[model samples]
Target: MGEVRVVAVDVGSVRTGSFAWAAVDVPAGGPGLCGYGSDPASAVASAAEALAAGRRAVLALEAPMSVPVPQEWEQLGKGRAGEGNRAWSASAGAGALGTGLVQGAWMLSELGRAVPGLTVTTQAGRWTGGDARLLLVEAFVSGAGKPVATVLGQHAADAEAAARAVADRLGGEAGTDVVCAPHRAFNLLAAQAMWAGLEIGADELETDVLVVRARPVST
Candidate 1:
């Protein structure tokens, strides 16, 4: 009912740069970036601890709560390229889905160890349909020509991008709308620049906090 710190964690199956963290204060205004972590689960815990500041936190994961069945995997992978024959194509799809869904349970459990009573949901909750991932990708790419840097690693932006998505949904009920971090939001928010074409050349976020309130809450 009150403010909840919203953090989005983009889980990775790999051993390094496996996690990115982004967060925002709910019903108020402010965002914090956690960058990337080789041990992302631990990094997420640390990020939550710092941003929570003794408040409840909501975590949004870019993972499926349940793994797909073989048939389900086939369905998910249906219509992709290189599906030679119908049967082979189905098998290929299944393998791809299985690979992508691997160890998701471990990641979820790791997160549970960190934040108790932390609300969790899949990234699908944030979008309208099939192109959801692209939309988020667009949000990240849209920041081109803005001043942004990754203090953690290359994957950090994805985590923040995920965080913004989570905040937009959870904060929606609180009449809080989400928007992209301005070029300045990333300025000094990270270490020296590793990513190009996004830095706007500022050291800090000014009044234009990259998030702007666009409309009144409909009653």
Candidate 2:
């Protein structure tokens, strides 16, 4: 098992200063490289750069990677089972999710285009290091955000926060048991990537979605 790098992108509009990303190379320690960008290309490039030989890269997107459709179709207005206080379709979340849909897909497509051998997996447990692989995750930075001092601004701080959350998970932290459930929306982001020609490892109904939650801060 070699080093694992985690890159988290705080998804926003396509306009300048809207999109921001942070990357942390585990074992090397703290936040490695982070910046704000106008597009997802820069973030994609960062992930590609992190995918070195004998290393694994985890790409965390602060967006709704999967929409859990309730058993009662009319109950679509509710959130996922474990999403207690923070619902994906809430005011702010809804906006971010809608905007991130295309950007996330584009980022995945670009990653596939950039790295031919990029083995993308939604399961974090399968992220055993040693070989070059890419793990995709949905970053949950909601619920008053992570307990971290703001840096640069909210966007950059959020990016770093998400990165730290993912890093902690890879370091053996307990994970959220949120299920993406079997639906047309399962693996939503990856499905778009597949439609764009990326070779997906099989569209399973009940697959794992790495929902990396930020560390709790004690009051």
Candidate 3:
């Protein structure tokens, strides 16, 4: 594929929640909302229509990469080998791990089968923060100069934030790593996934949010 469509998805395992967004028509100014929904499958469908299969694209998922069952997360505790995040214990918890293995793994598998050539990566590696909420707020205000969750909701904001992270990483900083105090992973995922596609949003073309300077965030 010549171009790349940046798609970020926040999937909920079970009733938690799931949402998606595609930074389509990036570069003019800001990108529009292509895949915006609660259902992972449906959200991808929406994004698929808005995305061009001809171009190379990647899907960033803030979910667990793999989990055998719901209770497995609790047993995992803090982490085992490469399964947990030292920066924050959230990645070791049962809830986070559960969703990752159950919902996250399922989504990754499903998306791979459904979308041809779509690269999906889990955000649960050593690249996330202890407080997802705090990181999200920083990403929103720093990028847009305001609290975006009110308008986009937590789910959409999460998806948007991930998309922005991906965009910033693939732009020019792909060669470097985004690390903060305490040796956290931060925006490492974006940089690590540089081989995949990530682009800037446009203004001339219509999108959900106007282009606001969004960059890699880690703290």
* Clashes found in each candidate (C-alpha, N, C closer than 3 A): 4, 0, 14
For model 1, the superposed segments whose C-alpha errors exceed 4 Å read: 16-18, 30-36, 47-54, 64-104, 111-152, 173-219
Q: What's the lDDT for candidate 2?
A: 0.71
How much lDDT does candidate 1 score? 0.36
Q: Which sections of candidate 2 miss by over 4 Å? A: 28-38, 52-54, 129-132, 147-151, 180-185, 205-208
Model 1, 1-219: lDDT tens per residue? 345555554545465545455565556664444333445455456545743464555544443212212343435423312112422125533443343234333433454455443332122233222211111111121232112446665446565655655556544443222222221111111111112112222322221112212122234
lDDT of 3 by residue, 64-182 (tens): 32222123345432332332232123533434434533443344445445554554232322112221100111112132322257365766677676666655554443322222222
Put down candidate 2 lDDT per residue, 35-151, tens digits, no spaces.
Answer: 444457888887787674556788888887777766778877667766777788888878888877788778888888888856666655555633228777889886665645465
Clashing pairs in 2: none
Per-residue lDDT for 97 in model 2? 83
> Which one wins by TM-score: 1 or 3?
3
Ranking by TM-score: 2, 3, 1
Q: How many pairs of residues collide in model 2? A: 0
- In model 3, the Cα lDDT at residue 49 comes to 46
